[model samples]
Target: MRVLGVDPGLTRCGVGVVEGVAGRPLTMIGVGVVRTPADAELGHRLVAIERGIEEWLDEHRPEYVAVERVFSQHNVRTVMGTAQASAVAMLCAARRGIPVALHTPSEVKAAVTGSGRADKAQVGAMVTRLLRLAEPPRPADAADALALAICHIWRAPAQNRLQQAVAQHASALKGRTR
Candidate 1:
């Protein structure tokens, strides 16, 4: 599966594409940060992010988009911006009918590094190793985005099985009732 992972931020939204299935090495199709002027108006920043995400969608055409779920932070303003940027990413994927998955930072960290509390450097080092890159992607955000993609690629199979089992159970219940 091809996944586009988004690490949303007003100043620097990270985007990356990874393609492969579980138990196999994945390939990085692209990785970069979408920068919007920190001093720009909120609306303009969001628009810029929209355009950048749209471009990624057009180019990579991922089957799924894995975005970091916004969590509460000490700074309300920072959290608000992150939530806004995250919403933009979900909107972009939904508009294209591509499924969007929201993964918490801890969940992604654990999937990639086997530790939920792994630091940025640890996560970066793992991403570099997983992708077999000579070095970690620049700007911690970029590596984080790639890590998100790798996490999704590895986790999706089990998630799909769980979802199917739930659906089958519901269908069996409906048949019994009818």
Candidate 2:
């Protein structure tokens, strides 16, 4: 499966694309940041974000988009921007009919580093090691995006198994009724 993970920010949104299946290593298809001027108006920043994400979707055509869920924290301004960026990401995926999954930062950190409260450096280090890269993913956002993809890969099996069980049960019930 090809998954695009997004770490949304008004000024600098980070995106990473990885292709892999459960229990296997992931291949990095692409990784980059979408930058908008910090002084830009909120509407303008959002428009830029939408356009950037659309272009990325057109280019990569990922099967799924994984985004970080917004958490209410002390910084109201940061939270607002994060929420808006996430909205743009979801809208972009919805427009293209691509499925989206939202994961919490803690969930991503835990998946990558075995601890929900793992620090940014720890997560970055793990991302570097997992991808077998020489350097850590820069600027934190990119690292977070990679971590989000990892979280999805880890979580996907449980969901797929549940779906398969449901289908099997339905098939058995139909056979008995028929």
Candidate 3:
């Protein structure tokens, strides 16, 4: 499967594409960061992000997009920006009819480094080793984006099955009620 991972931020949103499946070697198709000036108006920043994500969608044509789920932080301003950026990513994928998945930072960390509390360096090292890259992607955010893709590539199958089971159980329950 080809997966695009997005690490959304106001100043620098990381985007990465990886192709692989569970229990198989993954290939890094692309990786980069989109930068928007902090001084730019809110609307302008969002526009920039939208354009960047659209370009990526058109260029790589990922089957799925894994975005970092926004989490509460003491800095409400920062969180708001991140949430906005994440929305743009989801919208871009939705417009293209591609599936989107949101994974928490801790979930991503655990998937890549075996520990939810793993440090940035550890995650980077693991990402490098997993992708067999010569070096870890820079600016932490880039590596994070790649990690999100890798996590989804490894986890999505079981997650899909669980969702299917839940839906089937719900359907059976509804039929019995009827």
Give me the candidate number with maximum TM-score: 1
Residue runs of model 1 more than 4 Å from their true location after superposition? 73-75
Candidate 1 residue lDDT tens string, 19-85: 9999998899999999999889999999999999999999999999999999886467799999999
Error of 3 at 38 (Å): 1.3
- lDDT of all predictions, in order shown? 0.95, 0.90, 0.95
Per-candidate TM-scores read 0.96, 0.90, 0.95
Checking candidate 1 for backbone clashes, the offending pairs are none
Candidate numbers sorted by TM-score from highest down: 1, 3, 2
TM-score of 1: 0.96
Tell me the lDDT of model 3 at 116.
93
RMSD (Å) of each candidate, 1 decimal: 1.1, 2.4, 1.3
lDDT of 3 at 162: 96
lDDT string for model 3 (19-134, tens) is 99999989999999999999999999999999999999999999999999998774686998999999999999998899999999899999999999999999999999999999
Question: How well does model 1 score by local distance difference test?
Answer: 0.95
